[model samples]
Target chain A: MNPDLLPLALGINRVILYSGYVLLAGTFTFWSLVWPQGRKDRHLLILSIAGIALTTIATVAGPMIDIWIAGMTWAEVFSPISAAALFVRLAALAAAAFFLVDIVNYPIASWRRALPLTIVVAIAATMVASSNAVGGPWEVVKLVATMGHVIATAAWLGGLVALAAVLIPRQYLAELDKVIPRFSIIAATSVVVLLVTGTLHALAIAGGFQELVTSDYGIVFFIKVAIFGAMLLMGNHGRKYANGVALRAAAAARASKEAKINHDKLTKGGPGMHSLAVAMGAELAIAFGILLTTSLLVFVAPH
Target chain B: MSRPQYSLPNLRRFLGACVVTAFLVTAVAAYYGTPEPLPASVDTTSDAAAATGGPADQAPATVTIEPEPTAAGVELPSEGPGVSEPGLLLIAAPLPDGTWDVSEQVMLAKPTTSLTLAPADISRAGSQFGFARPEATSVQVSVGEQPVVIPEARVIEQVSADIPSTTRFEISYRLDGATVTTVPSTARRGIGAIMPVTSGLDPDLPVVVMVVGETVLSLSCPELSLSERNCGTAAGDEAMILAEPLPFGAAVVAAQIDIPRL
Candidate 1:
């Protein structure tokens, strides 16, 4: 492999891996935190499976590429660190798949729903620990900051994707009043955590503002942050539309005591819901842009 | 006017377009954002053989050096505070027992907290040891005054250390006992030392400096035979080896030094 192309290849692999993590983690966050009563939708399941496949590919391919770059033999491809990381990731994926099957088949209690979320949090920590940044100074602080960043990213971006899965298909139009508010709260909290942890990570890795602007890593980091800002704006717009739909739904419920009102027509086919869908779709698109810039950041040297 | 219906198919199409756009933008960013590829190592074995119209194993032509014998023996070239061309500086002293005491100094343009040094390949043309490969043992590395510790078995033929903040460091190792032999089909005998012209150095100028305390009977760079400047200048006691300008990978500096006795 051409050493020059290694960074590009690694970045692409990270995109696939990160996408999988966000989708899977987001779906679980939606099920557990946003809409506990909502059953597993087929589209969400498909999205989760896709995430598993992408993560598996990245987990397996990452080590192979590292070994090849080091000019090591094939037998040495699975070094101790690589092997441990791969095993933990694969085990987490398998457990997630099992939990998804159970959620889809059985009507489990709301408390048991946190299993997948816990698993994903473990996966997030594994990712941070296995990164090249582990052996550096302030190791614990960096790991905690990075893990928090990844989890918050999964909650926000992944939850947005899960929201799209349900909202676009009008799968649970009646529950929109409850679902949208809950998701808004989770996303708001996530955005706050994301900003805090992201700043800490940037300060720790990039060293200072000068390095962030001058280095390749800094440039890509800036781009990711810019895309994230765009996502936040779009998210705010979607929340407003969601609030409009929720207010109208509450009013319809109050008026329905006197006369029959078509709840589906009021919530599903309304302009408010349409605007929310468009805004969310745009947010998801921008989220992918953030993921791409993040993947590039992995290969770029910070200072 | 009716609001646009966001059917499942429509949503999928919109997302597909977004994904394509994201990929295009990311690809462009990556193309410009990533570091440039390293230069490729120049393989000069075939070219050297073809130039002389001799067998591949034929000994490379040698340049005999008769330095003005000073009373204090050969003085190694002085490396000033600032390095003009940052690369490896190798100084070898021929011991009475037919072994060379080698000390390699790494000069990098950028300051690094850690450094990894790989053993040189001794099988190349002009190396004194034809078949016997010598392992670097009792390797000691220090950045100025602080001695860096080397782990026992992380890599093969390589030693890495988390060194102090410095751009210049020295690695000294003993070549226990290498089987000394002459180049094939030639009576010339010398010590051949190959060092790397590390990346981030001026490829157009001399990147490696080899100094031998004993008198230099013959000097030649087998790898750079095809270039216009096949070899660099040999002063009183040191030889400067020129490196071919390669864009990406580190180039090899193969120097064959002939002393009075091997």
Candidate 2:
């Protein structure tokens, strides 16, 4: 294999693995907390399964790529650095397994679900420890900041996916009424965290404004920013639509005779629901592009 | 559902708008941020080996020095901003240890340069390899009809590598018509190759680019075990390298051929 190809392939693997873990943890958290019938929802199970499958692929492929790039035998993967990576992958696997067990044994009680969620948080923490931000000066400080960034990203993106796939399609104004507004708050906080951590990372690498444009790394970084901008626009539209739905639902709930009529109309493919769905879907697509660029950014030389 | 006096929907809209505003403002601030002034010249002649504060008693490599490549003009695609000639750009960064971390990137000149080193290079140090080449301060090259100028190139951290297992050490480039191939520096290990190239002339003027380096440390052990290994020197030590005026040469089978404008 071409030596450079190994790193690029490994970068792709990371993107896939991270997406899986984030979606799994984020979707499950929202399902358990907000949705009244979340536990019984098949969509939640499917989402968890998909996340687990992707994480598993990454866990297996990541180490192999290391071995290939190093031109070392399989036995060398037990080295300290590889071991750390393996640790994160294993935690992600365990979290996925827990989700499977929870699904297999239906009605396992609410408290028991916390096990998987706890494991999910552990996965996030381990990921942060193994990232570029950590293993450097002020390790603890950087790790904490990176961890916050990772968790917030997982929650925001995963929640959007879950909302679009499960809740938006159902279009119950009452459910939309509860989930949309609450999700908006969570997303707002997550975006703030993402923006802060992302900026810090950029400043650390670029060092100055000149480096950002002069270097190849800087050029790719700008591309990421552009994709992020698109996501923000879509997210704004989605938020507005959600807000409109909530207001209409509230007004309809207060009316005695027209309550059922208004609720049926809103629940059955209303303009607000369609708009929110499209906006959320577009935002998710743009976010995926951002993630791919991030993988490339790490591999490029940051002058 | 219970309704509060204040509208929750409005609150959601306000928060969402706030996040978007924050995102846009931060991006704008960064893109248009003031750039620092560029240094007039980088001190390329400095003997990095002596300055590294390594063990003073250690002896340097004893290799016969061949004639360096002659200074000659080569036609590049253009002299536009951010343009690089299609060839091997050998960069040597001095590490904390006396040795130098010599890396080569197969650069294809494009309208917009988005350059990245072969992952094989970053993995040289294993997982801890942050891929940060802080030592590659500048590029000194002579383009046709233009004064030799060292333009700034950015390097980002890629994936990690196992120091001992990373055997690819030499950097070589070969230009074949429209295709430019970079030989896996690892194939040569410590020994480098100097080859002559035709400088787009009728008689084919030979331009010699010499790439030679000595590995200060290499880990070789049974079964990839970290602890039980045979590394002559401490890990993370760099390979000592000397590249005379850069020139294209014969490439190895494993070398990658990158077509420009693709």
Candidate 3:
């Protein structure tokens, strides 16, 4: 078995597991906090269950695959060299368990609050800490930056999926007026963290602008940035719709009952919700492009 | 155009399309755009031998130990092209202890320690010798008590008893099946050691070998504190380079000499 394939398998496995993890965390967070009295979301529950299952499989199979690549038997997995890999596997397992717990107790306001999401975020942080991105100098800065990048990616991508899959499907129009603007804040903050941390990581690994153009690492990195830009455009489109709904709702609160009914038609019985969902879905697609580029980046050797 | 379906299944299909696209892109990048393959070790010994009008036969060279050297207080087997007289034929055969025992002709009997020397083929003509061991692994050669350091160039000539005054030699190292060639400096006028500064060369085997006239000198590997895996890198590489030459005084004075384990 070629050891080079270990990173590829691990990266793809992480993509699957992280996508699931982020979706579950984001969906549950929304359900617990924003729409506590929101309809029981069967789709969200089913997706969470499936995500947890995939993460569980990924968490177990990752180390086993690596052991095969290292040409070591299962007995040698406890060796010191395998320690970091082992820690990652263990942390992923713990995160999967937390996700499992959250799914089993679906729609329980207390159970779904912040705890599972925090665990997943912490797991992602550990992953960055153990990654090759933090291998060079200024260990603290690199680890923190990489962690921020990982978390922000998950939040943005996962949150978009939750909005399109869960909230939109249920036609939670009143909820969207509150949640979309709130999520836009989260997305905006995440984009800032991503840009700053991503630049730092690129500078640390890529050396210079010429390297970004010349090397394989740089080529894929630029593609990721392009996709992120596309995602931003789509996100901004959805943000405008959400902000428009929020503005109309405020105006209706101050104005007559006729104005309030008009506002309800604009959000609920109209094309506004469908348009927002379409834009958010496009953003979700671009998010996958970003994840794909990220996985490629992991596989490419830094110059 | 038609209000754009936003049902759960439609969203699932959209997300699924995204995942599939990502998967294809990642798979294509991983499979198609991987790094270039590592260079294979090249063996130019045959070409060198052919240029020198040496042995054309690919068969292993036979060595005969001179009996007089056994009686001359030095049991050093006179083998290959360097041997002046034929006496005993040196061959690697399995002993009763399960480990392959090198011919008694090459090694002096020591009660505390036994060594296994893998048979290496050498081709030579007049005063030119070529050595090659194609196999990645060879029989283990063990040293007892303490590691011996080869003496400086001047002493090597005195101990070997047949030193060339103007030995023109080229050293080549085999790394991952590719042979890299380098010419050793003949300025020492006697026995100049050949050392590899490159990390590409394997330290366990004949990464670099020196030929003095027609005689191929077998270098020694010191029992360093470094692990076998780390022996060829970092400080271990430095140590190996420093320990490149055999102690001429000890090699001639002792019962037996040490050779590298490939």
Candidate 4:
């Protein structure tokens, strides 16, 4: 491979890896937390399967590219630290797959449902810990911040996608009142986590304002932050629309004379629901923009 | 009381808007934030030559000699301390413990702000089998009367003063206790030893000089396989080697010095 192009290739690989992680983790979080009924939904199942497949490809490809960039020999490629990390990721993926099958095939208990998510979380943590550890006096703090950043990203982005899977088909339109409120709460909390951890990560990595303005890594970071801000505004708009729908649905239920009529009207997909869906679609697109910038950031060294 | 409506057009519009916004942001960032290309690596000499319809080989390597002898019994270049064309000068003075104290001086063109005297971690992949390049133990750089500080990081930044356009950078560095490797000499009946010196400045048109002791009988720069030409010149105790601009990853200047006696 051309040495100059290796970094770009690595960045593209990271995008695929990150997308898979987000989908797998987000879908699972949505099912377990916001809407358990989504577990049976075929769309959610397909998204989860897609996540697993992408992650599997990334897990294998990531190390091979790294070894090639370093120009390592065949024997050197199997160094202990790298081998151990790969083994852990593969093992966790296998266990997560088994749990996913159990969740789909059997009517398992509430406690048993958490197993797959737990395994995926372990995988995410391992990936974060291995890549994000910039050793220094603040090493522990940076590691913790990066860990929080990854989990929060999974919850927010993943949850947004999961919410789409729930909302898009209009299959669960009658249950929109129940679903939107739960997801809004999770989304809000995840946003707060993302802001805090992202700030810490930016401070640690960029070091100073001059670097942010001057360095390639810093410019990409600012672009990511801009996209993130756009995503946030869209999320807020979606929340307001969701709250309006939920409130209208509740008011209809309270009216004794025309409860069925009003509830059915709300469930049938009005202008409010349509607006919410549009906002969500926009947010997903911008989320992908953030992911692309993030992939570039991984290869572009900080000044 | 009505049926579900899925508007594909609305979804497409939102996605399109996001894409346009992202593209704009990236374009702006790229335009404003890209760094100036590294001057050392960008060789414009050949391109300029090609554009001017002149032979590229007409431009010769610039060799700089330092006045002070690095060790005892080693003579300064016979041409004296000044900028000379198409030749190199290196000096290797023998210490009490039998190791050679090798040193070289080169004049580099002034950079806009700073110059890197020695790059950190010069070891490249597949370097183990090749000749050992010289490592700079200590380096001194000056532009006219202004002494540039060589940081432990090996970069010499001229922060305090403006560098003149006609600035001549005199850089001297010791090759920490260079051990000579024995090689058979065809020119004279003596022990032939080859010493590899580091190319501190641009590898393109590098002029390296080596000064072995007065016992030196002959010198030759071996052809660097099929890629590089022999550019070694020997007169008295000094050996100068000049070659074509090296391709990426080739960084050693080896000169075989035959000494009749150690």
Among these predictions, the greatest TM-score belongs to 4
Q: Candidate 1 — which pairs collide?
A: B38-B248, B38-B249, B39-B247, B39-B248, B39-B249, B40-B249
Give the per-residue lDDT digits (tens) of candidate 1, residues A5-91. 444555677788899889888877777788756655788888878887888788777755544442322222332333344566666
Worst lDDT run of 10 residues, candidate 2 chain A, spans A72-81
Q: Each candidate's DockQ score against the native complex?
A: 0.03, 0.03, 0.02, 0.03
Clashing pairs in 4: A264-B1, A265-B1, B88-B209, B89-B209, B89-B210, B90-B209, B90-B210, B90-B211, B91-B211, B92-B211
Candidate 1: segments with Cα more than 4 A from true spot:
A1-3, A68-82, A107-110, A208-214, A253-261, A267-271, B1-262
Root-mean-square deviation of every model? 18.5, 17.7, 20.0, 17.5
What C-alpha lDDT values do all the predictions have? 0.57, 0.46, 0.42, 0.53
Off by over 4 Å in 3: A1-11, A28-40, A69-114, A207-214, A245-271, B1-262
Model 1 RMSD vs true structure: 18.5
User: What is the alpha-carbon lDDT of model 4 when measured against the actual structure?
Assistant: 0.53
Strongest candidate by lDDT: 1
Candidates 2 and 4: which is better by TM-score?
A: 4
The lowest-lDDT stretch of 10 consecutive residues in candidate 2 chain B is B253-262
Residues B20-68, model 4: lDDT tens digits: 4554454344334432111111111221111001112332222221233
For model 2, how does the per-residue alpha-carbon lDDT over A1-303 read when each residue is reduced to its tens digit?
333344456777889887887677777666655553565567777787788788778767776665444332232223233344455446446535534554435543377657556656766865664455543345555666677878888778888777777756564456666777778888888889988877666655555568666655677888988998889888888878777776777677677477777777766656767777778778888989988987777655331
Can you write out model 1's per-residue Cα lDDT over B200-228, one digit (the tens) per residue? 33444334444354333223344444333
Q: Which ten residues in a row have the lowest lDDT in candidate 3 chain A?
A: A72-81
Candidate 4 docking class? incorrect
TM-scores of all predicted structures = 0.55, 0.57, 0.48, 0.58
